[model samples]
Every structure is written in structure tokens, then in C-alpha cells.
Target chain A: MDPDDLQAEPLSSGVPDLPPSDIGMSVEPATEAGAESDSSDTSSSSSMLEDDLLVLRRAWINERNSPELYTYEGAALENLMELVDFQLQSLDAQPASIQNDRVKYLVRSYLRTRLNKVEQHPGYVLREMKERLSQAELEYAEGFRSLQDAHVRKSFLDQFPAHLRRVDEETKDGLKMVPEPDMDRAVFCRVRTTVGQFQFDERYVSRQRRPAYLVQTTNMQCVVRTRSS
Target chain B: MLGDECFKLAKEAKDVTPDHIPAYNEELVRLVTQESRYLWRRVVELIQATESSSQQSSSGVFSPSQSTSKPDLSSQPFSNDPADVSRSMESENMQGQVALYVHTIERNKRCLMAYHRKRAEFLQSLLWAVHLAPTMVPQNVSQRLAPEEQNYAREYAKLNMKYRDSVEATLCPNDSLDWALNGEVPPRDLLIEVRVHRDCGEIVTQSGIVNLQAGTQHYLCRSDVEHLLTIGYLEHINPT
Candidate 1:
């Protein structure tokens, strides 16, 4: 028998077998709603086919550069490399989006830690900070949980406004709303309730004058601060 | 992409049934495959040639048996005239260049091991991919196992295992050195000599040698730097 007479398909990434819905339909966009609506049994079979294809594609991608698999030649090897390059290009093109989503959680984490500090620190506004902080904490948790089911986590983060610091009447008339220098710009958003919308021009500065958005607006700044020792 | 072009060529390049190929375009496939194979083999040959030259220089400096087994000639070799062949030979007889010898020996052993391991793995995977092709093999393995390929596979596995240990042990020392250099070097006693320099409060070593990976100038040292190379403390120094 000749060595060049066989036929085989590529392998898939060895992901733990997932539930049918996640492993199957989620890989590619569902193209046919008619096929889905006509028969549940047929839908399940088509879903399985999609699942198998995903498995095969993922396996080939994972092993593309692995020394354990394909090399620098042949059609299969070339296809695997092309797939990897495409994924890499996609990743590069969406850095801001990915970072924005990540920063959303990081901001919540930062605020949670700060709220803990506020609880420990002594001040007249501590009580007000504590109340708003607790509310923000609850909202952040709820938002995160809801985000898990969304199309993308970043858009969910964009919708979350709990990390914003509200300029409210606590005790001090003058206030400083300072943005964390290292905070990711993507997740950092400001909302002015008095204007009934988000504000772009009103930057976070370490001083207080009149509210920049509106006369009686609830000006909120998503800022980070260092706890004074 | 090159892949698409190749695929189109393969798809449209006339029927390669038993009537067309070298025994079914067998000879053409073999020639293309062998051309790539020969390119890599040429690379290995160059590596061997360089290694042999280094070994010869070392042997000229000192014989291996004399130094590892004997102790009388260590300090005396340094006195020989660097220009005189007879004196150099006598010096080599007295004290072998054990340090250079050991370095080269270890290096060659590592290179040969890497060469074999990489070659085997590449061949194994390449063959595996070819086997998976639509028109490549018969229906069953029993019919597909050519005696030569069977032997090649066994030999590949053996070489793969043999060199696997060496490859794993051979790590680049860039990261650890970078950490140490960054934290301790500026204020420490170790003087910056040769190409070592400080950047952003980090001590870094640089040398001028071509790098194999990415063929890019790495930030660490040149590829030919003779000191202990580990991935932990070494990085390639990119010119830019």
C-alpha cells in the first residue's frame, strides 16, 4: 500500500465535554431559525454536527503551533497556521474592547476595597460614604451576575454605573473628585444626573466649584483614591 | 495567503491519479518533500561543521584524556608562546583547555540532541499530516504500513525520547538574570564589563549575534554568548 492514499479529518481541541447548547450552537451564529422551529429532534442533530465541527477546529487551532502536532509545511499545517493568525489578528484589533470589559470589573474591585477602607476610617461623611458604597457594592454584584449571560462582558460593564462617585451633601462643601491616573480610560465614565445624561467634557479634577454638568445635577465621577495612612 | 495559492494549485494542477504522478506523481511529491528535507539537512550539516571546527581548536589546545585523568599540567600551559606551534602543542600536552573543552563538549552534545529531537518531531508530525490526507493512504493501517516508514517511525521515537530530556534541561537564563540585573546590579559590586549595561535601573547584557527564534534581535544577549544560557535570565537583544 502506498503512503499517500489515506483520508482523515483534523482533530479538535480537547475541551471538557460541555452541555450541548454551549458546545454546539454557540460556536457559530445560528443561521436557520426554520430548521430550529420545524423539529426539535432535527435541531439537536444539526447542533451535534456544529459541535463536532467546533471541536475539530478548536483542536486544530490549539495544536497548530504545538511541537506535538503539525509543522511548517503541507496543506493541513498551512490551514492551521492561517486559522491561528486570524485569531491573533482578531485579538489585536479588539484590545480596547477587551480591556474595557476587564477594567469594568477592576474598577468594581477597587471601589469595593475602598469602601472597606471608608468603613474603617473616621469621618463625618463616613456614614454617607458607607451608605452609597454599600448600594454601589450591591449594584456591582448584580450587574456582574447579569453580565455572565450577555453577548459580551464589556458592554455590560459599559452599562454599569455603580462605581461612580456621587457629589452629594455629606458635610464638606468643597470636594475633590480625582481620577486614578492608571485607571483604564475605557471603563472610566462620568454621569451627571442633573443634566439627565453622561458628560464628556467635565473631567475629574481635585477641586470643587459649581457642578459642571447642571445646576443641581448629581455629578458622579468614577475616580480612584489612595487611602491615607 | 500562500496556503490558498498552494491549495488552488494542488486542486487545479491536473489529475494526479496513478497515471500522472511519479508512480502517480510520486516522484514530484518526493522531489518537493526532499527539497525541504535537504534544506534542513544542510542546516544540520552547517551546525556540525561549525561544531567540528570548534572541537578541533579545543583538541589542538588540549587532549581530553590528558586533563580529566591527569593533574600535573594545569598551570604550565599558560606560559607557552601563543605563536609557536611546538610550544602550543607542548602546552596542550601539559594542560588541556578543559574549560573550553567542557564548554564545547556540553554545547555540541546539546546541539546534536536538539537537532535530532526537532528533526524527529517535525518528521513525525509531517508524516502524520500526510497520512491524514485524502489520497495518501489505504483504508487500513495494516495495508498502509510501509516497512521503511515503520523503521523511520521507530527510529524517530527513540531519538525523540533521547533528546527530549536534553531539550527540557536546556533553558534560556534571560528572565532570572534580568530580575537579578534589574534589582541588584546597579548598586552591587559586580562591575559592568564587556557589553553589560544598565537601562531603566536594570542591568542587561548584550552581544552581537544572530538569533534563531523570530530571527529578531532579542533584548538579552547574543545567541553565541558562551556563558550559561537559561530562559530564566536571558533574552535576545533586538537592535532596535
Candidate 2:
């Protein structure tokens, strides 16, 4: 995947489908069954399809690596959906309906990951980072939050006095009730481009060289993966 | 014991191997919930005292030490000197204890949430894996869920379908698209041979009805047998 794709690009159109060919897959022997497999198993898809697939892959990798949600790629997903639906209806392409499944699987994974993150850090997502979610995801977030609030209230919070019923406030420990993602945690990275130098913790001076970078993941949104390397 | 019960529940929630769902720990959950309520009540009592006292003074709500207002009503009934410096010190000490109790209560809440959320996640995944067919959930799995958890699973399954339909609404609507179907690796061949492992009775496939008595073999579309493959009713026959 191109490192440049990590930088913010103009909103292309639709959901950048995930390549969830891995995690949560019920079937076995699942390894990189993505674009390369798409090409090998069938005659080459049109260049446009290939391009859309690349965008989807880039989106998938970006969402997979980053702790924070990126903007949704709605246009690319819509286009791919039309194409996959077309292929499914085609007489010859019906056998390759597996292609549609792959696309659907990837898209489902992308959405699922976002949902996981939303559920994990609802306070942060609902307050500071809502712009990153698509319309459907936004609705899901609001609904899930209310669902949670209702659950918490019905289950135990109601047992407490009205003042203590509040769940999202800071605790007496001076820590937040809702945990935000720990950005300061160290994350391993591979350098796509060399940087001359950057200060670490205002104490140590370090230089990033090509092929590897082991920096704390805080605010380091550009998670470039050197898959070919 | 303040955190031990919740910590144990959290550890069990994370086990992903050898089938994810474990039988609900009803007794422990009840105990934890009771402890949480007890601690939370204490915290509220302390905080309420703090709030009432702080409202009379100009000092910040949390900064009981920096308080300049006279500590009149804060003195204990048994105290000889109601205005003594020790009176303010006592309130400060109470504030510190409140902080500790609040921490314990919140931590307890987090653990409880983690356990419940983990089970909820498992339920959602199982429902999706079976393509939203609740009846397809294995009997052992169904029996393990708590009654309340069972209700949550049913409601959540319905919500999940609506969520998927809304996701579909983002795309063209004419052709029915199933996002949860065949969440497996794309097979190189569209059709594969499979041997029945158990008596599945007569089952209809994409082709036609086939009796799935033990040892019966048939070639079927991978998608057609996908559910059976997951449920262990049939075994994939790899052609050598």
C-alpha cells in the first residue's frame, strides 16, 4: 500500500471496505485473501474495479492500524456494491459469487471494527470525534449509548441516590469514568519515509530511519505498513 | 476483597480459545453488584455531605483544604470545640476517604461492564455467524446465557438486522445484499465435496434435497454448505 494514502485525501465517495479476511472469520485457512486472490482466481477485473479495490485495501489497512476512526469512504463502497451486484446477476459471473461475499465480508469487518471502537470509547467518540463516523454509524452510536444508559440505570445505577446515578462523570479518584484510548502506549511502526530528527518526551533526541520505527503511538495517525518489505 | 471479585470476572471474560462463551457466573455477578451498590451508597453519602458543606462556602467543591468559610455545621455532634482547627481537618479526612470509595465503586462498575459487554459481543458474533438465525445457536451456547443476557441477545439480534439494513440503504436497494453471509475465506473452487458426519436428516441444498445420513457424501456449493460446515454436521472432502 502507498504511504501517501495515509495522508488525508479528498473524500472519494463511500465506505472504504475493510480487508477483514482475517479476524472473526469462522472459516479456516484465512490469510491475505484480498486483491491478489481476487486477481488470481478470476480473469483480471476492470482497471476501475482494481482501483476501487486498492482504495478499499488502503481504507482497511488505515482503519486496522489506527486507534482513531478515519473518515468513511462512502463513494468507493457504493461503486463496488453496484459492480458486485452486476457480476452476481451476470450468467458467467454467478459462479464467482464468492467475489460478492468477499466484498461484503470486508465491508462488514470495516463497519464492525468501527462499532467495536465506538462501544469501547463512547464518551470520546460521541464528544470529540463524531465527525469521523458515517450517518448509519452515527445513528448506531447514539442508539448504543442510550441502550447502555438504559441498561446501566435498570441494572444497578438506580439503586444509588440521584446524585450518584451519573456514570460518565469523573470519579473521586480524579480519573475519568469513561476510558479514552491510551495514546501514550508504545506502538511498533515501519518507516515509509525517513525523518531527520524528532524530540522524544523533550528529553531524548532520536532519528527515524527507513524500514523501522518504534515510537509511542500517541497522535501518530500515519500508520504506514511496508507489506512488500 | 474490594477488587478481587471483579478482577476475577474480568479475567474469565477474555478467554477466547476452546469456544468463547462460558456459563454465566450468576453468583459472582450478584455478589459484585451488591458490593458495587454498597460502595456507591457510601460514596454518595460522603459526597452529599461534601456538597451541602461546600455550598455554604466560596471554596471549590473538591478543594476542602483551601476552604476559608467557617466550619460550623461540619463539626461532629460529640465534638467539644465545634470551631476548632481539628474540625476542618476532619472534613478533609472525610473527603480523602470519599475519593477512595468513589475509586473502588467506579472500578467495580468497569469490571461489571466488561463482563457484560464481553458476553454481549459473543452473542452478537454468534448471531451474525449463523446469519441472524437465533434457532441456529447451539443448545449448549443458549443454555449458558443468563435470563437477562438471553433477553439482551434477542433484542440485540433484531437491532443488528436493522443496522445491516441501514448499511444496505447506503448502497443501491433493488438487489438484496447480505453482509453477514459466508464470512469465510474465498474458496478457489465454487463447489466442494463434503461428507456428512451426523444425521442431518433430509436437507435441501442449492441443487436439491439430499439425505445427510452419516457417511453420505455429496458435492455442493460452498455457500450452500457453509452453515453445516460451521455447525460440524459435514466435513469438507479435500480432493487429493
Candidate 3:
């Protein structure tokens, strides 16, 4: 599959999953409660569909690039999952299955990426962080920590000291014995704006090529192309 | 000397062959944990020594919560007081030692976590790698795993098998075929050219059973031959 085709979607970085309510209404004001009027209806609905896909793609890239767990794109994921699964039920050898397959692959990759990250530091993610994981992911993390704890007890108890066995124990100087993401790690990005005086970090940006000023307030329309190293 | 075992453990994990699991260094893990225990004991001793000095120097100045003492007060507060200087100096020395030991212990914990997590991930990916070939981790590979990892691998394989079967059933209940284990995205074309690198007796395709002879070429429907390409019976010869 040409990932570039779905590259219509923008990557997220703490970006909200869906466009804000006002931006959504402004994008397609008449289509919300409009009846089955054929001409304008199809066009509006297709455009809305395109917008939804863009948000989903953004979530995909954002999830891919972030060092730590980005915000869960819960709403976008729910909408895409329902739409693809519903389409896939009667999808008898149709070419459209290709697109559905792409969606499935993206969702699977996104979820798996998060799952791998969670596995790497289950204790840290569960105990130190908040709201970055979905409810399902949180439960899985809890289960994983307990499972590993039980496994460690069964395997390493005889040799390991009792006091040192606790992985999350803090030291006397208040240093936590847990893995943490390096927030200052360098990341690559394809920038189209001057990005002068970024609120997060001024040094992370410098150059610009083509500046397209966006007046809309939708966080889902992420203009930056993440090439995070 | 402080974190030498941990340093070696991380290096050993990285030095092994890329595609194989390394032997678990249980001895190094024990030594590191033991190091952490000793460091903690030393820190506790330092804290006690500093706490006693703080009490004696402060004289009649009563500290309510005497368990945890704070050296947070700057030199300006103690500059005018003569007795405070000696206590502050002693506390400063102990705090620095405690800080260094604490950082080393945390570093040791991270190294230990890195080693185990690396081995665990290798076990997880192995299940997927051996899916189309042999189902289970062969006896030789399983022997290399720690006891906990072996159990993890068994449980993970079972979970993957269940997930694959359910997904296949949901996708194509009547027709028995695969929904995954293909190219990342399904190829665009229906017909694809393939080269047979090895000799195989016969395999069924949509047209009919084709004799998969050695060094033969055929333009078969992609659906009929994609699985063969995956299993190394055939290779997809891209048209130039």
C-alpha cells in the first residue's frame, strides 16, 4: 500500500483527535441535519469522510513519532474502527477492501506501537503518568505488571535481595528507579512555516519553505510533517 | 566498581547475534541487585549520622518531624551562627555521598530493566517470526530463555494463535484463508510473476495444480502464489 496515499492524514502531537465543534460546523455547516438531497449531500458527506480520514492519519503519525505515549485518539479510532468493520462484513472481493485493509493495518500498527511502549515500562507508565493511555491500554498495563511481578518472583526470588526487588523503589535523594523518556531527544520534522518562537521549545525549529497560514482552529489539521529521529 | 556488573550486563545483551536470544546472565543480575542493597544501607547510615549531628548542633531548636531532615537551608541562614557551620558541613558531605549512591542505584535498576526488556521483546517477536515456518519455539531456542521468559513465550504464542484464528474466522468464515501474514498492504495487481528457487512436487492454484519445478518461472494470480512467496517456495520477480 502506498503510505503516501493515506498521508492525506496529518500527524498528531498532543493534537486533539477531532476538529473542535466550531471548526467542524464551519467546515460543513449545512450537512449536519440535511436530508437525503442527492447533489450537495454526497459532496458534503465525502468531504466529511475525507476530513475524518485526515484526522486518523494525523493520529497515526503522531503516535509513531512521540517518545512517550501521546494522547489516545479515542474518538477517531472509534469512528474508523466502526466504519471499517462495518464495510468489511459484506466486502466480497471488492477492490474497496484494499482501502479497508489499509485502515486495519494502520490501526493495528498504531495499537501495537503503543503496546510495545507500554511493555517496555509498564511500572513507570502505570504509576507515574496520567491520561496518556486509553482505558483498555491501562488495564493491559496493569495486567502486564502483575504478570511480570509474579514471573519475577517465581524466577529470581532466591538470588535477589528482598529490598532491591521492588522495581519502582525511590532512593534517598528522591530519585526514582524507573525508565523515563528523554524529552530533549532530537527529532526531525518537515516544516513549512517559519515556526518562530514556538511555545514548547524555541530551539527545535529554525527554517521554513512554504508557509501556509491556517486561520482555522482545528488541532487535527497538523501542518508539521514529523520525521522524528 | 559501583555499577560495573550493570554496565557489563547491558553490553553483553547488545553484543549477542541480532536474531537470536542471548543466554540470561542471572549471576550478573544478582550482583547488581546486591550492589543496590549495599548502597541503600550506606545511604541509611549517612542519613542517621547527619540527623544526629543536626540535632546536637541545633541545641534547643526543636524540629517537630525529626524523621526526615532537610538540608535545604542555604549557607546564608547559618552564616551568623558558629555551631551551625560544623553541622551544615557534615550534613553537606553526607548528602553528597547519599546523592551519588542514589544515582548509581537508579542507574543499576535501569540497566537491569533494559536487559530483561530486551530479552522479553525478542521472545515476543519470535512468535510472529516463526508463525508461517514452524509453530513453536524449537527446543534449542527455548533453552536459552530464562524460566520466566519461557512461560511468557508459551502464553504469548497461545494468545497469537487464538487472535489469528478469530480474525480469520471473522473476515472469511465460509472460505478458509488468511487475513494477515501477507505484505504490509495487499499488492495492487491481480497477476504477479514468480520464480521458483527450489523444487517442489505440486501446489494448487486457481487455474489448476502447477508443477513447481526448480528454476521455473510463471505468471500466476497473486492470491494463488502470495503464500508460496511467504514460505520461500516462490519469489515475486518484480518486472523491471
Candidate 4:
């Protein structure tokens, strides 16, 4: 069978063995009741849906711009893209009530599509961070190997410890070693932070005045004076 | 509220199904309803706040008596007075928006429930397939399953003969797997990639010992990792 033909068929049809009540009747009453009660609550809910739509729209735009979204299985991605397009088109053609419903579905599908991209896979930021860390490690290893060969190193620390450290470690060590290349000296220099004098005031100062205390004299002072006299 | 009732019913139905498949249908419905309700309340608050502010600003130009009556004006749902046509129009627009939102929520609830039901049915069918042909449980099939799903499939396969016979009689005869084992040739062993989600030491397979660690990916025969996949410790990855 053609792959396209399989896509056209409802994917849910794969499981048709469920009891009629299990699949159908059990759901209808609850939804109808929900719809009825929802009417009473609609005034309040309408504004909520608008906010949800706004967030969903923003998310959809972000997904479209995301580079990782393209990595999704071709058929699923195409289907979601088409669904979004259809929803947008219908928004104009339908009445406000219908349009509102369509917008919710659109937002939901958009979220699901975005979710499908990352559901099994790790988040884009995490994967990117891992890749960057690995690349940095590889670069550091390459730099260390090259430095070892140039300095006739034995232990890991001996290769570039003292004079080599003065030059920016990020640059080629060869340029720093040979003084003839004065033009490249600027590139080899490390950028250092300069400290300036800073003044700081005490955070807390006591505002309350000290209490006065009366001094009491004992008979010992008079007795001593009399004895001396 | 209605979503909650549906969720309760779905949960009840879950008890009738096999133990292995996690009953996520109820939880999904509950989450959707809860989220929708919170959003609805926020929207109402926003609309009310904006309306009250606009009334306050507009009332500043009017007399004290009219200003005093502003609370009443806000309380009234609709105004028949011709002078307040614009206010009435705005109210109608808001109502329409609300109606649209309610309809959308109801539709979403129904769709989610249907998907849940379908998923449960699919699991039942998969169990039936396992019961019919234990050996035909392909390596790729096991690898595709999560750990819990594998356990569930295996556990269901181990049900007593009476239960299996009853399931066989009731199960729909139109499943694609009904004819899976009719062919003459023996099933060939397929090489597949399995990614360990959790650490598992030296699994002895027909081929050799396969050591697994979290975040490690390995290529092995389908049979070696089928149990691991079903139990959710390992996930199947398409070979790059």
C-alpha cells in the first residue's frame, strides 16, 4: 500500500476491537453536560481562551523558527504544517464562534507538534550544551597535545607552566616563543582586569541615645580620707 | 466539572483492562479541564477589571448621580437603552468569544477521551497478538515498547488458558496481526539499536552478554533487549 494512503486513513483505526459502550456512549453524556455547563461559564472562559490563543500563537511562531523542528519525521511534520495552514485559512472563512473553536484546536495541534519534536529527544538547549562542551574538550585536548610536542614535555604540567602561561593560552604558543613576530604580539597578550579604589560605608548605624546612669559613692572613700588625715 | 466525571468513568474502566498499560486517560482529562478552568477564570477577571476601569474613567465626566449609579450599570447583564448601543455591542462580542471558548474546550475534552479509549484498545489488541503467537513477538516490537508496556504484554501473555480463550473469542477478527504467523518461513533475527534509560548489568542473550548503562547506546539483536524495552529501562533508537 502507498504510504500516503495509509496516512489518509485515521491512525486510531488500528484498534477497532473495543466495545461500543467503552468507546462511544460513555463519552457523549459527559461532554454534552460539559458543553451545557460550559455555556454558563463561557463569559469567564472566553477571555481565558484568548490568552491561551495568544500563548499558543507565540509558541507556534517560535516552533516555526526553531532549527530542530525540521528534524522531525517528514510525514508527521508535513501533516502538522498542513493542519496549521488549514486552521489559519478557516479562521477567516468561519464565524467568530467557529473561528474561536478552530483557534483552540490550532493552538493544541501546534503544541502537540512541538512536543512531538522533543518528547522522546532531549531539549534543544540541553543537546546544544552537550555538543558545545564536547567540542571544547576536543579543542583543549588538541591544544595540550600540540603544546606537549613543542615543549618536549614529560608530565602533564611541565609543557606550558611558567613562561608559556604569561601569553594568552587561547593563542598559538609558537608566536609567543618567537619574538620576531611583533605584529602578532597584541593577539597573544591576555586581557586583565584592573582594580580601582572603592569606598564602602557601614550598613548599620545605631540611632538610639545611651541612657544616663547615677553614680553612688560608698562610705569607704570618706573612711580612707579620714585615715589619711 | 464534567471532565472530572468523565475522568472518573475512565478510571473505573481502567480497572477492567490489563494491569500493565498505565491509565493516563483520566489524568490527561483532569489536566486539560483544570488548565481550561484556570485560564477561564483569569480571562473573566481580566475582562471585569478592564470593564470596571473603563467605566471609572468614563464616569469621571458625568454627574455625581450617574457616577453613583455606575455600580448598577456594571451589574446589569444587558441594556435595552438606545444610547448604550456601543456598550451592548461590546458585551455581545465578549459573549461570542466566550461561546467560542466553551465550544473549543468541550471539543478538546471529547477528542482526548477518544484518543485514550483508542490507546487502551490498541493495548488489548497487542496482548491478543502476543497470546496467539508467543514466538512471533518480533524483536522490533519489543524494542518499540516502554519497560512497563513490555511487562504488561508479558504478564498478559501469562494469563490462564481460560482467560486467553475468552479474549480470543471476543477480540475483533480484523486485526492486522491475525495473519502474522501464517507464513511458512521462520522469523529472521533483526539487528536493532537500544538506548539504556537505566543501568542494567550483563544481560545474557542467545548471542552474548550485553552490558547496559544509563545514557549508553548499543546495537544488539531484537530478542536481547525486547524485555528491557517493554519494561521501559531501554528505548529503541533508529540507527543513524
Error of 2 at A204 (Å): 11
lDDT of 2 by residue, A1-229 (tens): 4444333221212334323443223122112222434434342344456666667766765565556666777777787777666554443323444555566666766677777788777778889878878888887778777766766566556665465577688755577767687667554454434544445567543434444444566535443322211
DockQ each candidate and list the results.
0.01, 0.24, 0.11, 0.01
What does the lDDT read for residue A119 in candidate 2? 73
TM per prediction: 0.18, 0.70, 0.59, 0.22
* CAPRI classification of candidate 4: incorrect
Regions more than 4 Å wrong, model 1: A1-40, A65-229, B1-96, B118-150, B154-240
Comparison by lDDT, 1 against 3, better one: 3
The candidate that achieves the highest DockQ relative to the unseen native structure: 2
Candidates 2 and 4: which is better by TM-score?
Answer: 2
Residue B115 in candidate 4, Cα distance off native in Å: 1.8
Residue by residue across A23-105, what tens digits does model 3's lDDT show?
A: 23322322322233344455655465556665656566655655566666666666555545434444434433334444555
Question: In candidate 3, which residue ranges exceed 4 Å CA deviation?
Answer: A1-45, A78-97, A127-132, A172-175, A187-229, B1-7, B27-110, B131-135, B138-140, B157-191, B195-233
Ranking by TM-score: 2, 3, 4, 1
lDDT tens digits by residue: candidate 2, B42-84: 7778878867765654344345564435354644553234343
List the per-model TM-score of the A chain: 0.17, 0.69, 0.63, 0.23
- Can you write out model 4's per-residue Cα lDDT over B1-240, one digit (the tens) per residue? 534544554554455343344434435544555555554664566578658856854664365754455454544664434446566566667767666555444444444434443443455465444433434455755554444444444443443233323322332121111121212111232567888999998898656677898999988765456556755788988633
**Which wins on DockQ, candidate 3 or candidate 4?**
3
Order the candidates by lDDT, highest first.
Answer: 2, 3, 4, 1
Interface RMSD of 4: 29.6
Tell me the docking grade of candidate 3.
Answer: incorrect
The 10-residue segment with the lowest total lDDT in model 3 chain B: B177-186
